[model samples]
Target: MDIAILVKLTSRAWSLNILASMNSGIPGRQAPLLAATSASRTAFAQSLDHLMQLGLLERNPGHGHPLRPEFRLTKTGAEIAQTATRIVQAVPDDTEFALLRRSWTAPILALTHRPQRFSALKSGLITISDRALSTSLQRLEDSAWIEREIDATLRHPFPTYRAVNQGFAVNQAIALVA
Candidate 1:
């Protein structure tokens, strides 16, 4: 899965969680998804709508009442949902879910899989602002998901970031799908 695509899919809170829940065999109805993701009704509805707009999910025709439509993943959505499931499984607990929910965290972690400098990471996630990238890097470091190491071999030493611990697991999950 491309980082850009993943980032877009996860821009809304609970979107990834919703996909993971469905991929894990949960029923496609609203009630089950809402329960599985633990998202507020408004947020869940918005994420569901976002996914539908992206064409990753759609209303299941004739399978559910108009007031309670069921959803099914499109072909592209199923593949992405499988990746989302793996990434969710890699998270150690609910605390980490907050980090993953951030727009840049998962994409940043994925980029750090091979170790990258701040500028490199920012470039990889084209639209991220400097402050947003820096904040995300700090949060990931604080969570011990990534390590910042200063490289002295070069004439101008620079800090490099690499995924570690849970971040490594998530990166590996993304790698498997990619």
Candidate 2:
């Protein structure tokens, strides 16, 4: 997905509300800031549900109010949020990654040393167009060189690409031949 689109979907307005309310130790109630933007209870509920599905939000059971639930980021969700922030900051203000098919082997390999979201991987060095990035990631996945978990923690979400076991086995075989 495009970083711009991702940012819009995971806006500061939504993130702050979830983080603030959780930090404030409130149980299940929407933060005042989010409540202002939502206007209606239904809208707020829908927004909350969307975040939950993204794995960026979670609910905590309220001791007193069964209906009024507390929401917070799951570990994976928090990592994605932080990684998103890094991606935003890392991209040059004036330039979008325009090149495609340019070798991303170096950066991709480095990120594989420590699994990270696609955004984080992109942020680390190479800047390629969204399409190219997607294609490359898909190719890696198809090759069984990487695996992604649909609902991972904040520290690792989205396409947290890693060296597949098969990849390692192949590397070992190649090393032996060499």
Candidate 3:
């Protein structure tokens, strides 16, 4: 599994909840899923749409909306859901990985395994906005997962960063997703 795919699966608050409902063998399609997850309609629908788009779910041709609709896991979806279930076991409320629920956090943390200047991280992550990158780095620093150091070698001094704890849990999560 690509780390990016895992990141998206974990990023949304209810994404895992929706997947867990489907994997739990509940019936009555979205109604049961919504009830089981207790998520608002908008969040439930959005998560369901994302799961379907990820190919983790497919509409059951046997049923359709208006009267009723059904969904089933694709083989790939089942595999991922099974893996996700295991990942879920390790995280209760998942506050342990709160940072990971944001898209930029994991990639930023992964790159911070080594000391890196802001420019190096921004260039390496390509497609991340300057504001977002700076924000993610600041959050990580605030979380005590990383810290800044003065880059005295520069003509004009600048700060570089390196992971402090490097978050063993996050590393384990990356392995699980893989």
Candidate 4:
């Protein structure tokens, strides 16, 4: 499975619940499971169907009760789940850091000095939401490309940020871009 798809599925409460239930050898009761995971019945059904098509799950033969159908993971499903877990756990904390470094090249070169926030950085080169900008900043900071300082001027202040030594590489790349 694609890492992105696996990540999205694992992160969703309903999918994870279903996976966990299957892992534990308990067949999920569709309606109750959907209710517990706060997912729509249609969405839950779709996810289950997709898993089934992927050879990750199978519908158990109906027992005496025709109304209740049980679902269980195949051996391949267990292996996929294990692989997904390993991949997710192995992801670096600064997952977006490299992308952020590449993205900020132009702005970094244009700036006489580093900006205090990604909003300040984005103003010149690209349009991004405040939330996305903040996330990028956090990623850069986590990767040691930037450092944060307390801003004393703002009431109920936020941290001020500036590029660290690692940003020099980004600056150099930017200088070469044109």
Candidate 5:
């Protein structure tokens, strides 16, 4: 998975949950997927449409009702879903999994494999706003997925971030996909 693709995959809040559920052998029908991901109807529908547009998911032909169609992963989707399964498994709790659903979570985690300053992370992500980056860092720090330390060796002594524990596991999962 390229970083950009991973970004697209996690852009919708429920996209990863949908993919993980499908990878876990949950039925491909909308009702089952909604139950599995616990997503609201509109969000689930949008995510399903997003995945289909991304070429990761498609309508199943000769199966399911036209009004309530079934879906299946395309070859690329299956590959990405497998990667998503690994990431889903790496998260040890629901709270952490919820963090993973955030738009910037995976990319931030991927960037934090090595210690990096806030500016470095922000620059790496390009489009993330300062507030979003700050909020994400705070959340990841609170969850203990990452650690922040003062790099006193620098002239300005700025705080740097790095993935730790389960964050490391998630980063590894992303690397495997890459």
Candidate 6:
């Protein structure tokens, strides 16, 4: 809630990415995580230490002579990680890459993991209004993450949406969020 805290959280490079990588159950050891995150060693160490200090992660200090210790999320960290997993990912939640950072983008993608029509999506999301869903779908289409299929069998042709193969990886990560 405070500006200082906001700045502090956003200041840590590759921090959120680490959480997402972990949340997807990638790895517990440093080397594997380093590879999974593709973060520079120095930056990864800094972010790992900061996350531990924030009570988000824990290291097995008593094991493996400390030099090659194991790490995992603390209870607090796991809880937060579950909640933030969608945004924290192998790909940073930057606006430049994908629209997943938009409020409903990930949720919409999650719902569209399989093909679905406009009405199904609106009803499934419940709180999303028609306009908001339309806008989110448009963004996904613009990014080429979702394909729009028109069905003319019905009196009025209706559009059904499905995610492209490339979108599946990110959508799966968000689905594993909790």
lDDT score for residue 127 of model 3: 72
Estimate, for each residue in 10-66, the C-alpha lDDT of model 6 and write its tens digit. Answer: 346656667766788877688888997677999889888888888778885655446
| Winner by lDDT between candidate 2 and candidate 1 | 1
TM-score computed on alpha carbons, candidate 4: 0.39
TM per model? 0.96, 0.33, 0.67, 0.39, 0.93, 0.53
Residue 88: error of model 2 in Å?
11
Which window of 10 residues has the lowest lDDT sum in candidate 3?
Answer: 166-175
Backbone clash count for every predicted candidate, in the order shown: 0, 7, 0, 0, 1, 0
Off by over 4 Å in 1: none
Q: For candidate 3, write residues 1-178 as lDDT tens digits.
A: 5656765675555666666656767763888888877778887788888888888888888686855678888888877776655544544555655565566766666566668899998987777789988998888888877788997886999999877664434445445655
Ranking by TM-score: 1, 5, 3, 6, 4, 2
Better of 2 and 6 by lDDT: 6
RMSD of 2: 15.8
Evaluated against the true structure, the overall lDDT of model 6 is 0.69
lDDT of the candidates, in the order given: 0.91, 0.47, 0.70, 0.51, 0.90, 0.69
Shift in Å, residue 18, candidate 4 = 1.3
Model 2, position 109: C-alpha lDDT score: 34
Segments in model 3 whose C-alpha atoms lie over 4 Å from true places: 7-13, 20-28, 35-38, 63-68, 94-99, 110-120, 145-167
Lowest summed-lDDT stretch of 10 residues in model 6?
A: 1-10
TM-score for candidate 3: 0.67
Model 3, residue 11: C-alpha shift (Å):
6.1
lDDT of 5: 0.90
- Per-residue alpha-carbon lDDT of model 5 for 1-178, expressed as tens digits? 7777888888998988899899989989999999988889999999999999999999999989999999999999999999888898898588668888889989999989899999999988888899999999999999888999997886888899999988899999988856
Candidate 6 displacement at residue 5 in angstroms: 23
lDDT of 4 by residue, 1-178 (tens): 4323343343333454456445544545675556544557776787777777667777766632456676666787876655433322222234432243233322432341454554565564344457656665676666666677877787876676666654545443333322
